[model samples]
Target chain A: MIHFDQVSKRYQSGHEALRNVSFRLAAGEMAFLTGHSGAGKTTLLRLVALVERASRGQVLIGGQNLNRLAHRKIPYFRRNIGLVFQDHRLLPERTVFDNVALPLVIAGARHQEIARRVRAALDKVGLLGKERLHPLTLSGGEQQRVGIARAVVNKPPILLADEPTGNLDPELSREIMGLFGSFSNFGVTVLIATHDIELIQRMNTRTLVLSKGCLVDD
Target chain B: MRAKATTPHFERGPRFQLRAWLLRHLQTLFSALGELTRSPLGTAMTAGVIGIALALPAGLYVFLDNVQAVGQNWDGKVEISLFLKDQIDDEAASRFALSLHKRSELRHVQLITRAEALEEYRQLSGFAEALNAFEQENPLPALVLVEPTLRYAQPEAIKGLVAELGRLPAVELAQFDLEWLQRLHAIIHTLKRGVVVLAALLALGVLLIVGNTIRLGIENRRAEIEIIQLVGATDAFIRRPFLYTGFCFGLLGALMAWLLVEGGLWLVRGPLAELASLYQANFLLASLGLRASLVLCLMGALLGLAGSWLAVRRHLRGIEVG
Candidate 1:
């Protein structure tokens, strides 16, 4: 579950990114965050992930307040939330399997357990046969799939994606959305932030639209 | 069921966590080694600097040990000679020697009467013909040679014993070369202290070397560190590989230092033996033995760990999750 109550983020240079945004997504729910380039969709996702703490009010995930979390506990806190970026963020030097296994490794899983989960996650993303191949050698869509596989490999309860299909073809975008849908069906909460209005319309899920620094519509 | 089966399994229990912790450390240990091997030349150069620094003090320590052993050997050969007054005759000197022999501090006492002294002087001295002029008087004084027990054979104890013996009514003088022996002891003591100071400075240098190397390693892997941090890798996990890198540098550097010390000692052994033979003394150069070498390696590893810890603490805070 994810909840934001009057959350606002202001940069050090006095630029306000988000202002008094409020939303709540129940467990196993899937939603889309839609806005233009400077509308704070990324900032919202960052607040939920605790990458950048909300400058005002509260951002909560699974009943834990992001504002009051101690600095040392941030890593453990992030473990329960999976994040994907527009650029895929796959380590180019590592094999596809190693990229997916990162989250499980961070969780200190056993070697055999990691291998098994990584293969299964790769299978979910339709990348099972490309496990040994490096990300640079893979196509753009395939690399994005690897990133999605990595984000879910550890089976985090909540998933956050920032324009994960921004660079993919429309067909690949639909497939990635389908993966998120199936994950939500299995009782995992999923939130996607994107600027592609057409894709958001096609998603047809609970959508929150941001304009300027305000949550204009939900 | 298929979705449920893939749900993350949290391995609980302290024993299981500890085992996993150890397994992760083992993995990092080898991975760090692999990282170093990937940049062989750079690693060797850094380790070589550490080795030379370590070897300097280690060599000096071994040298000091050898010198102290030789000094102890000479300490065993101390002898005090007591010259009797003119009033002390042969029978009186022999009685004095007997009394001195009974003292706990004296190991042995031998009395040489005036007649025996004159005879020894006549046979050894080339002035035997000239000494015949004083044959009637036989002016040589009676002497008692005193050898101190091992405990009292040192310069300080010998000085005290000499002073006590000089107070004897029949003894004209109690003499030993205490000044030269004291000088030798002073030199060795000063050199030992100097070696300790040098060792400490060089150890600090080793720490700096390891720290700098680890700093560079952290800098090169900045992206990887940031990404891992974002993916829920703890600071400990991010720090593990760098610490291991420093450890490898220290361990390998210590091994290098050991080889340098052994080689240096080996090169000097033959020449040192020849020099000892020229002085009519048998001496052997002592190398850093197995125990000492192992200790050196351990010190290296510890220094490496400390250096990397310092570097990581200072630099790791600069990198945060994006």
Candidate 2:
């Protein structure tokens, strides 16, 4: 579950990334965030990830107010939320398995547990056979799958993606969107930030549109 | 295929937590080692630089240790030379030397008759031709050399003994160069202090060297660090590998320092032994023994850890998932 209480983020350079934006998503709900390039979608995801704090209002996840979270507690808080990027953000030098196992490793999971979970996650992404292969060797769509596998490796309750299908072809984008749909179906709250209106229409999910740092439509 | 993907959470006991913590550290340790091995030349160069820095101080310490050992052995060199009165004949002086030898404070006493004294001066002073001009009547006084026992070998004790001997019958002057002995000790003390200062400076240098290397490593892995941070890796987890890298650098550097010092001492030992033999001293060069090498290695490892910690603290703050 994610909730924003009229959050506003004003950068030091006088740029407002988000302005008085408020939204709430129940557990297991999936939603798409649509906005122009400079709109506040990425900033919204960042606030959820606690990469940046809201300047004016409270951002809550699972009823926990993130604005009050201590600096040292941020890592533990983030463990419950998975984030995916457009570029995959996989360590190019590492194997697909290693890339996926990172989150579990960060969680201090046992070796056996990590191996099992990582394999399961990889299997879900159809990357079971490419575990030993490095991310760079994989195709663009496959690389994005590796990133998705990494995001859900720990079975985080909430998954956030920022333009995850940006670099993929239309078919691959559809496939990636389907992967997100499956995660949501399994009770993982998903918020995908993208400007791909056609893909949003095709996915037929709840959409929140932003323009000039304000929620224009939802 | 709808898989039941509900998250399962379990509470672990402290023992399990500790084991998992240790396992993670072990993984990071080996991974850090592998990273160093990946760039063998660069690692070697960095480690070599640290080795040279550490060796300067380590070598000086071993050198000081040997010098102190030589100083201890030469406690007998603090001898008191007693010159007999001109009226005292050779037999009486020899008898006096024999009597002096009975004292517990004296280790040895040898009588140098006037003729023997003249002959020693003629051979050593380069005044053999000048000494022949006074061949009929030798001008040198009969002498007695008295070496104090080890327990009474301190400058103060020797000075006390010299004063006591000065008052003895048939002794014109109890001559001992106490100033020279004191000067030797002063020189050794100053050199020891100098070595300590140099060691401190070089230790600081080692810290900086390791710190800078770790900083560069963090910079190069900036992207990976950001990714890990975004994925909820704690500062401690991200820092573990870099700390290990520094530790390996320090440990390897210490090994290299030991080799450099031992190899240097080995090469000079032969010449040093020859020199000692020429001086009639049974002295051998002392190498950096096992205990000292172990300490050197420990210091290197600690410095590496500290340097990497400092670098990580400073730079990790700047790389906040940007």
Candidate 3:
């Protein structure tokens, strides 16, 4: 559901983060974007998320060209996509339930709908009973699950995760990958940017690799 | 034996849904409030600082208002006194009074003949024995008390009128009671300038105080904001809570200042009344009116909103999520 055509992003200081990157992911497909540090993986995902514009080419999500979207319309465009970060990114002062409910809140769902959806999402991540607990009180795996629940709470069609399992153990990482695989089964397109070769091999999804500022292979 | 339950369908119009969309973002408002509540002490301190800064100028404004009120009450009574020549007789003085009465500049003119003035003064002053001890006729001239029209009560106008009156053959000396009015006008002018300078300096102080507080807030919440942006939250969404926080601070500060000013006026009202009583005059201290209060509150809110907006616009750009 994402297409990047000859995408390039260059910083103001003349450093190129992404160089003529081209990729396409089909609907409901899951992919692992593998790269080292400063390898343009994050830059590519950022382009898809429309947080940063492509410097040279078109980045399309669904059928809409992000480069052509007005700045005021960016928020509406983002509602169809969900993003999870490696750090969980939970507001530490809030409960797990509230953290998971953030996307719905942003989407302006009804209170009852928020409570119902948040509970269900937390249940899917095996975090139902822990909703009242704060993020600081949860383990890294639990916190990551909370972040994942938050990402999918609005039932976004496309889910992007940046190093989702970066801090988890091997077992926890596998479980997280399995969770993403389940999301794919539910027809949600998922692109996970990671450097975990073992996890990628185990999941055996489509793999896109990047080196320096260019996409080397897919 | 139970039948499968069907999901109920409720369809809302697109416009209604759009409104709902806006309503859903109330979380941003709540989150903003929550952030402020997280550090009640800091919020209170910041608001208190703003309140005191605003109160200084507001207090001065109130004081100047009272001064203006007192000046206005005295302005109505301003008049001129004309002393006739010692040789001028009653008929001549009476004729001069009739001429003065014909002039549109004077509101009222009363001719006080020398004998009548002496007898009236003697009866009122309770000094009949001193007047009787005088062997010769008293030297008090025919006094003409002339009340000027409001427009003619000004220093220049009164001076001009006095000169005109002095040229009259029946007059010996003509004096316009304009010195005190001149001094009062000068004082009022100086007060207005002082208010402007003091208000400007205090407003600057308020801006700095609010700016620094907002800066601190940005620093404290930098991480959380980065996370929000990374998760596809727009800059407007991220900036909204800070703006509300600043508004709350300003609003609360203004309210506190209003209270302080009213309290100060209340505390001094009794003494002011007692002092007025000693002077055998009725005086009322003025309080801040509704319009002034609203202006103060609006000022506080705008200051806070602007300060926060500046802080957020400057600091948020430097924080990159990707």
Report the Cα lDDT for residue A210, model 2.
92
Clashing pairs in 2: none
True contacts kept of 2: 0.37
Computed on alpha carbons, the lDDT of every model, listed in order, comes to 0.87, 0.89, 0.84
In candidate 1 the C-alpha lDDT for residue B217 amounts to 80
User: Where does model 3 sit among the CAPRI classes?
Assistant: acceptable
Interface RMSD of 2: 4.0
Off by over 4 Å in 3: A6-21, A35-39, A55-57, A70-72, A212-217, B1-34, B83-104, B110-144, B164-172
lDDT of 3 by residue, A102-201 (tens): 7666555677888999999999999999989999998999999999998887777889999999999999999999999999888888999999998898
Off by over 4 Å in 2: B1-11, B83-91, B101-145, B149-152
Alpha-carbon TM-score of each model against the true structure: 0.87, 0.90, 0.84
DockQ of 2: 0.40
Model 2 per-residue lDDT tens digits across residues B1-322: 2222232232388898888878878888899999999999999999999999999989988998898778766564777889999999988988898899799999888888999999999977789999999979999999998889887877778788889999998889998877855677898899889988988888888889999999999999999999998988888888889999999999999999999999899999999999998766789888888899999999999998988888888988899895
Q: Fraction of the real A/B interface contacts present in each candidate? A: 0.37, 0.37, 0.15
Name the best candidate (by DockQ). Answer: 2
**Root mean square deviation (Cα) for candidate 2:** 3.6
Model 1 lDDT per residue over A136-218, tens place? 99998898888888888888888899999899889988888898899999888999998878888877899999998899998
